[model samples]
Structures are given as structure tokens and as C-alpha cells.
Target: MNKVLLQWALFSFMFGLALSLPLAAIHYQKNSSFKGIFTNYRKLKSAHLDYFMQALSAAFVYLIGFAAHIEFAAYILIPFIFGVILNPTILLLEATPYIRSGWIRFIYRCLRATSPASLLFAWLAIAFLFLPTYMTIILLAVILISGIGILTFLIKRRSRNEVGVKITEIE
Candidate 1:
């Protein structure tokens, strides 16, 4: 088992468990004052869920790598660790009122943009390490196609938005 991944998994799980305390407090308590502690309840909930998901993903990666006898390099594992930790943290920060503008907001936007790409690269790298060559090629092709499709959809949506064209108008 990779010690780094295992340690991060444990940390993420413990952090997630810790977050449940405040979540439960806000959930069960009827006091509006207490509920006001978090500005965005939805984002807080998303952060809580994401933490647990990241924990599980890290553990799964660790277990699979162990079973496959694949030793992951620092480059591969660094991105995975960074993404797992930062993704939920971004949501957690967004739930608060502190990061609204200025340099902090700029930094937050950069992190938000980077986290997904890091995780994608880490997962693809790990998959290539463990899976057979043919499967890796297939996986890469699927990912590329899916990315292109999503990009096309987003581009069309953006153009529609710029033209002030509503979905109802199109229909």
C-alpha cells in the first residue's frame, strides 16, 4: 500500500467526519442564528459530500495500485492528492462569505479551474499504469471524444447565451 495515499485517505475521512458535526448541528437545530453560520447551505453540503467521495477515491486508488503491484511515482500521486484535498476545500471556502472578491477570488478561480484537470490526469495516468495497452488506448479515445462533445455543447450554449436565445425560443 502507498503510505502517502493511505495517509491522505485517512485524513480526508477524518476531516469529512469532523465536518459532519457542524452539518448535523445546522441540520437538526431550529435556531436561525446557528443556520446563519454558513452563508450557503447547499455549497456546504456539497463540500461535505465531496470530501467523503474524495476519501473513497483515494482509498480505491491505493487498494487497486497495491493489488496490481504498481508503484505510483510522485508526479502521478501529487496531482491526485492535491486534487482530492483542494476540490472539497474550494467548495468549503465558497460556502463561507470570505472569498467574494479581490486576489483571493482570483486565486480561488485558478484553483477551481486546475483541480479537475489534475484529477483527470492523475486517474488517466494510474489507469495506464495498471491496465493493458489496448484498454488504455480505448480509455484515452473515449475520454477525448467525451471531452470534444462537452466542449461543443458548451460552445453552442455560450453562443446561444450571447445571442440572448432562450431554450424555449429554440424549441
Candidate 2:
């Protein structure tokens, strides 16, 4: 079940990335006033970029969870996937011509205010409301620590590689 979910997440991410080309072309034709091939249609451009990034981020999270054999796959992965899909779906709707309508703009405004990170936090908030508070806090802390560790390791590795290259050039 987890494997299937991860596969679906990968597919969704690729689909989101694939969506950018056609949307870019449409933007170019419809909203371009900047003497370029793409639109200055800021909101629409933002929608496509945000959707693609959110899907990609969700896929990354799913991959990490799968690789680590995390026990809470359903809890974490499901919300990530659902939010990734829903956020972009809302943005895509906003990209349509009817955004001038007050209701649609309002919806867009609300969703746009919350990014992928905030969506994850919102899930955490919901979980905290329902589940044991300690469990939620521990889970969040683990994720935070893991993120920091990974980033630190990556930075050190990058610096090491750069030093190695410099040494080789000098010798």
C-alpha cells in the first residue's frame, strides 16, 4: 500500500511538471506585454510554479518516508499528497478567466496565503487537536531535526568537494 501510494505521488509530481509547458505557452499568448515570449500574468505564472513545486516537494517527502520505512506513512504521506493536489487544483481554477468573480478570487486568496510548509503545519495542527499532543510534538521534532541534519551534511559535503577540487588544481 505504501509503495503504491509512493508511485502515485511520483506520477502526480511528473504530471504537475509536465503541465508547465502548455500553461507557459498559454500565458505567453494571452498575457504577454513585456516584449517577451511569456506572460507577465503574475498570478497565473505563480499558480503553475507553485503547483509544480508543491507536487515535487510532496514526492520528495514520500520518497524519504518510503526509504526510511516510516511507520506513519499514512498519516504523513496522505496529507502531503492530498494537500499537494488540492492546493494546485485551487490555483488552476484561479488561473481560469472567471477569477474576476469575487468568490473565486476569495478562494484563491485564502489558499495562496498558505504555502506547502504551512499546509503541513496545518495538518500538524489538526493532528494535535485530535491525537495525543506528545506524539505530535515528537513527530514534528523528529522531522525538524532530520531536516537540519540533512542540510548540514549536504553543506559539509559540498564544501569538502570544493576543497578537493581546489587542492587538485593547485598540485
Candidate 3:
């Protein structure tokens, strides 16, 4: 298995394990003061889960690549690592009130928006690296279709927002 990928998996797992202490404390209301640190329990729980899932995903990819005798480049692994780390981190930040508005919220949204693309690219790159040509083609087609759908949704949402702004300006 790729050492880097394995390391990331281990890191994610350990981080999740560490995070669970505070989560459990908050869940059981062990310390009322501790609960004040994280106002949103649900987001904290989600972040905890995301970390575990991301760890599993990293491990799964590493195992599959090892079994296929496919060696992944370090650069190709960047997106996966970025997504796995930042995705849960964003959730963790959301658990606090600091991410509610201003530049922090904008940055949070930017990170959130980019995470799906990073994950998709990482997985698709892995598929292309190991899978047969026919399977890779099929996967590429599906990804393209999904990308188009997401692009369309984003465009529509932007246009609606623009229209709303214009209407408010005219009033």
C-alpha cells in the first residue's frame, strides 16, 4: 500500500478518536461549561462521523490500489487528502458560532463547495488508474453527467440570486 495514503488514513482515524472525547462529554452533558465551547452538537457529531468515513475511504482506496498493483502519484493523492482533512474541519468550525457570518462564512462556503470536486476528482483519478478501459469510460461518462447537473444547478441559483437583487434594487 502507498505509505502516504496509509498515513493519512491513520491520521484521520486518530483525529476522530481524539475528537470523540469532547463529543461524548457534550453528549452526556458531563460538563456544562464544555458544552458551551460547541454550540451545535449536531454538526460536531457530523464532523466526527465524517472523519471516520473519510478514514475508511482513504484505506479502501489504498487497499484497492495495492491489490491492483497500481501505484498512485503523490500529486494525484493531494485532492483526496485535502478533501478528507478540510471536510470534517469545516464541519467542526460550523459547530462554533464563529463561522456564522462575515469573511469566515465566505471562506467556509468556498471550502465546502470545493470539497465535493476534490473528492470526485480523486476517486475518478483512482478509477482511471486501476480500472479497465471500458469501465473507466463508463465511469467518466457518469461523472461528466453529474458534473453538468451540478453546474446547471449552480448557474440557476446564481441567476435567481441576481434577479432577486435586481428586484430589490428597483423597489
Cα distance off (Å), candidate 3, residue 43? 1.0
Model 2, residue 12: distance off in Å is 3.0
Tell me which of candidates 2 and 3 scores higher on TM-score: 3
Off by over 4 Å in 2: 27-40, 99-118, 122-171
Clashing residue pairs found in predicted model 1: none
lDDT of 2 by residue, 89-140 (tens): 6656655665566887777676666545556764575456455778878988
Q: Would you estimate the TM-scores of all the predictions?
A: 0.84, 0.48, 0.77
Clashes of each: 0, 0, 0
- Candidate 1 lDDT score at position 139: 90
TM-score of 3: 0.77
C-alpha RMSD for every candidate: 3.6, 12.5, 3.6
Question: Tens-digit lDDT track for model 3 on 44-139?
Answer: 999999899999999998888788787778657888898888888888888978788899888899998988779878887877777899998898
Residues 55-170, candidate 1: write the lDDT tens digits.
Answer: 99999999988887877899899999999998898998788776787887887898889988899899988888888989988998998999999999999999988677666577
Clashes of 1: 0
Q: Candidate 2: give the clashing pairs.
A: none
Model 3: colliding residue pairs: none
